[model samples]
Target: MNLTTKILLPLIWLLCAIPAGLVQAQQAGQTKDNPSYAALADLLENEQSREKLINELRTMADETATQAETVAEEASAASSSSRELAQTTRAIAEGIGEQFTALAEVVNGLVDGQVASDEQFSLAGLMEATLNLSLVIVATLLVFMLMRRLIGPLLYARLDNWALHGAGNTPVIRRVICVALAAAVDVVIVGLAYVGGNLVATFLVGESGEQTTQASLFLNAFMVIELLKAGLRMLFSRRYDGLRLLPINASEAAYWNRHMALLIGLLGYGVMVAEPLISIHISAALSQGINTLLMLAAFMYAAIIILKNRRRLAGIIRTKAEQSPMATSKISLHLLARTWHVLALGYFAVVLVLVLLSPANALPFVLFATLKTLGIIVVGLLLSTLLGQTIGRRIQLSPELRRKMPLLEARLNSYVPNALRFLRFLVLAAVILLSFNAWHVLDLATWYASEAGGVLMGRIIAVAIVLAVAAAIWVTCASLIEHKLNPETGTGIPSARTQTLLSLFRSALAVLLVTMTVMIALAELGINIGPLIAGAGVLGLAIGFGAQKLVQDVITGIFIQIENAMNTGDVVTLGGITGTAEKLSIRSVGIRDLNGTYHIIPFSSVDTVSNYMRDFAYHVGEYRVSYRENIDDAIAHLQNAFEELAADEAQKPYVLEALEVAGVVALADSSVNIRVRIKTVPGMQWAVGRAYNRLVKMHFEQAGIEIPYPQSTVHFEGSRQGVAPALKLEQAGERYSG
Candidate 1:
């Protein structure tokens, strides 16, 4: 605007413009305060916040996409790995299938006789086998001939001498020696044959093929088996002239010998043939079939023999049962016989099944197991019988044992059979363990080595040893105590008190020993004996509380016994009861009064005890004499009576000291009192007193010394007017009548 006027005009224009600018500014301020404009500003701010939130969401989405891609890549890699692993597993399976197929083909070929053709049926093999067989037969014949020519004659001579010299009267030892000599001869012959056979077989099949090795084995087995059979036949011959080991009838011996030989031969043949077939790698199916037939035939033969002899077996079992010492043992024998019969049948059935179902390779093991079981049983029976008989005989013959424990001897005689049965059980357990080991059924050693089993076994062994030791100690102590307590002619008899104390002590010792044993056993068994001991302590405390009176009585009685205060047969006054102590126990004293009433007084209740018969007792007698009699004479008479009692042969031992008369102990109105005292041995006071009193009465009567009852004189004051008193009484009676 212009400066002056223009200033005015400019002022106006400026005022107008200022007004307009103020109006616009105020309107703008108002619009800002308006609800719609404020809402728009808030909407803008919200849009900006939403835009920021959208940007963050887009970043998160991108990151999530990257993570998902990584996960997809991992899944794809895992899938590829799994596919590769599956393909590898499939390839391995296919390889295994091919190997199995090849093995099957080899087995099929072998079973089809392709592998064993050359070894089994070749001319060279046949010739070698025949040669070996011929050599074995010739060697056996030579050995038999040599035995017959040299050793057999000598053996027969000795046997014949034994039979002629003793026969039925022969001692067991001599018979056993003759039998042993015969067995030796047979063994020598068989041993020679077997050795020769082995030499021939080895020479013929030296380092040869499977067929040759089989032939060698067959030849040796056959020779040994045949020799054993022959030896058995010779030992068990039915002929009386022959050496027979067992005492059996001719018919029974013959039956057993024939059947046993046949059974042995059949079993040996099966074993020999089956073993070779398996060793030579013959066809499995063919070998199994042949073994099955052989086992079946052997079993059938055994069954036939057993069935035919079943009656005989039953009779034998019954005879043994009847002869058994224990009646209960008959049941056991019957059970054993039944079990044996069942086992025989079951074993045959099981073996037949095994031969049919199992491979040829298992046949030898089965047969060996069966034979081993049989051998163990026979050996066990023989050993048990020998040990039982020898030990039983020795026990029965022991004079000292019989004298010391007559009752025990009788019991032992009765229990000898049971002891043998226990031995048999032990043998059975051992055999069962051995059989399990052979079959590899259970690893006992490994099990025993484990923590729990080791501890358990140790506990068992320790408990057994401890129990045995404890029993020995108990028996020894009991025997000694019994010997001490016995009332023999020369030995001092045990008094009732001594006997009672000894009995109580023995019972207490037994209780302590049993308690200790139980605790030790529980500890060994892995039981927490600490708690048991604590419980015992608590229970003892409770008993002490509950039975305090009993405990007190026992303690008091013990002290009294230790102090020798009273004993049985002593005249004692306990509490207020006076009687003879009949019995003494730990808790109470039993007494019998003169009235025949028994009193069992607890020691706790006995506050004061007075034993009359300790080391010595006193017997006192009182005699009253008339005043007219001479005191000196009466005293002298009493002394004479006492002296007479002391000199008496029947009362001399009871009277320890001479009697003394104390003159004039008390004087009554009519008589003088005199006392005589005698010292006597214990438990004789009453007898001495009675005798002294009776003697005093007899002496007083003989000496004319009056021993009188109590007397008193009464003085009456009779006035000089005794007649006036009588008159007054008469007049008073008359006046009362009026």
Candidate 2:
């Protein structure tokens, strides 16, 4: 219990433990080998030694921490993508090389008479299956051929007659139907072949393990190859002009059809049957190698065909394009001609590479891409043909219809050409997307099933619906306005005011519709349109502030129009200019005066508008006669002139009523002035005024009532102081002596 006792106990335990530890530590070798651990033995022996050991331990910890920091830095750098891309690329290349070498070895072994399959090869079974499939195909062909022999002549004859007669009016629909029917027949023939193959396989080939597989392979190859050839035949029917979908001549069609059919058949049989059989009976390696070799050969053949015919076909296509009636179609044809060879070459290259890259599983990928591409082309052609027929190459509106809707035919003419081009672009985009989908470049189907895709499609549909509704409303309003403006639309001639008001209304409607459509479309597209509207309001406020004159013009113009101050085609005096109101807009009015000078006057500057053509105009003629003439006689002559004016057929319609003679209105120094007032039709006042003036002058002279001329008495002011100054008017060149 004493402190000394505790210390001694601790010392005794330390001594005992040190000896045991020292014995164990001897196996760890000399102190120099592990000084740090050895220091532990001297921990309680010396203070200096303990401090030294502490220093050493601290130094060792520092070194360890530094090494750890270095390692962490290296790891961070490695984690970050700091390495060159070539490294991963090299790794992949090496992997493919190793895999390819291993496959090559397997294939070589098979070639060296070593089969890696569990079952022995059966050449007899293969031959028997092949023979059966051949007989099936032959029987199927014979059946179709006999049927064609019976019906083909009639079909061809009908197609020819239709094409011959249809071209003058329409031929695109006829061509499409003919091609589609022929293609269907070709497909049906292939169907018959497939059925015959199945029957033959059941009854003729007989079933066994390897035999069944072999027979199935042949049947599949026959069906696939025949169907593919059928499509090709539809594209370019041999010696059948009516059935051919392409625009090439019979010889060119026959050549392409034969070559393409052969190539397709070769690839189909090899890939579908031969390779599969080889893989099953011998080894997969051999099958893949054989497939790769066959694909390479086919690629070479296709390359040759494309290269050899490239220029020739391009020239032909160019010629066709040059002769095409539609500019859009011509442009499309030209582009196709320029790029088709490249596309074909690229397609083949891509297929070959894919097949080689994954020989075992590339069959579905390749077949799907090929078939999808063909289908897209066929469908596009059919659609184009249908569209061409529906929205014909040339649209001719009836004279009555054109007259009724004056602008409609022009609008359609302009719209159709651009629509054709736009539709072609849409078709091209669709084709590209479908092709990409088939190749798994982009999985559109997968996207369409996603939430985001659903939202997008819904928004698009909604926007389209909004646009359609807006368009319908606009068309209705426009038609109504047009009917009001057009005299021939069963509505009588519209007044100038009506025309001007309707034009302005149409412009306002367009602006309103566009604004509404855009806002709704944006909302449907998941855009927050509240901010857009706010921004627009702010912008409008800014514009209103900055363009006060414009606003004033518009406001004034509106008020002016509402008040019936002026209308288009009205002869109005505005802002000190007298002219016809030629063009009336919301902001300004265009006026052309009698002097042939055109003026654009903003309504804001118009203090007053004087429309000379309103209701009725006045033709006030003032007649001045010599003082010597009788005022009563002159008045009588004026009455006579009015009578003559009323009798004239050309001036009678304009002069609305009997002329009111304001008798002896003015008595001047040399003559008496009589004012005559008459009412005339609006805008015809000037013509009536001119005719009345002429009649008045003639009547005044005939009645000896002279028109006034200023007369002066020449009594010299200097002669006032003298008696009556004698003044004589003499002719020129007379000399006078004063």
Report backbone clashes per prediction: 0, 0
Q: For model 2, where is the 10-residue window of minimal lDDT?
A: 11-20
State which candidate has the highest lDDT.
2
RMSD of each: 18.5, 11.9
TM-score of 2: 0.77
lDDT of each: 0.68, 0.77
lDDT of each residue in 226-298, candidate 2, tens digit only: 7777778778887677777777788999898888888988888888888887787667766766776788899
Q: Give the TM-score of candidate 1.
A: 0.62
Highest-scoring model, TM-score: 2
On residues 1-738, what C-alpha lDDT tens digit does candidate 1 reach at each position? 245753443333322212333455456665544433333333335655446545755886799999999999999997998898787667645644554555465467666646433355344655665565566557656766776679655667668578547655334445556666766766777667666656655564444333355555555666667666655654466655436545456677788888777777676655675545443544444443455457668888878777776666777877777776544447766776666666677777666555554435566777577656655654554454454454446345376654544445555455555556565567667666766765556677887989987988899889877776766666666655665566652266787567667776777778888988888888888889998888989999999999999899989989998888887778899979999888787899899998999999999998888999787899987789898999888888888887899889999999887766677898777777888889988889899899989998999999988878866685545578753322222464464321
* Model 1 ranges with Cα > 4 A deviation: 1-135, 138-188, 196-219, 222-257, 270-289, 307-331, 358-360, 375-443, 479-503, 568-583, 590-601, 621-638, 641-653, 662-675, 686-738
Model 2 sits at a Cα RMSD from the real structure of 11.9
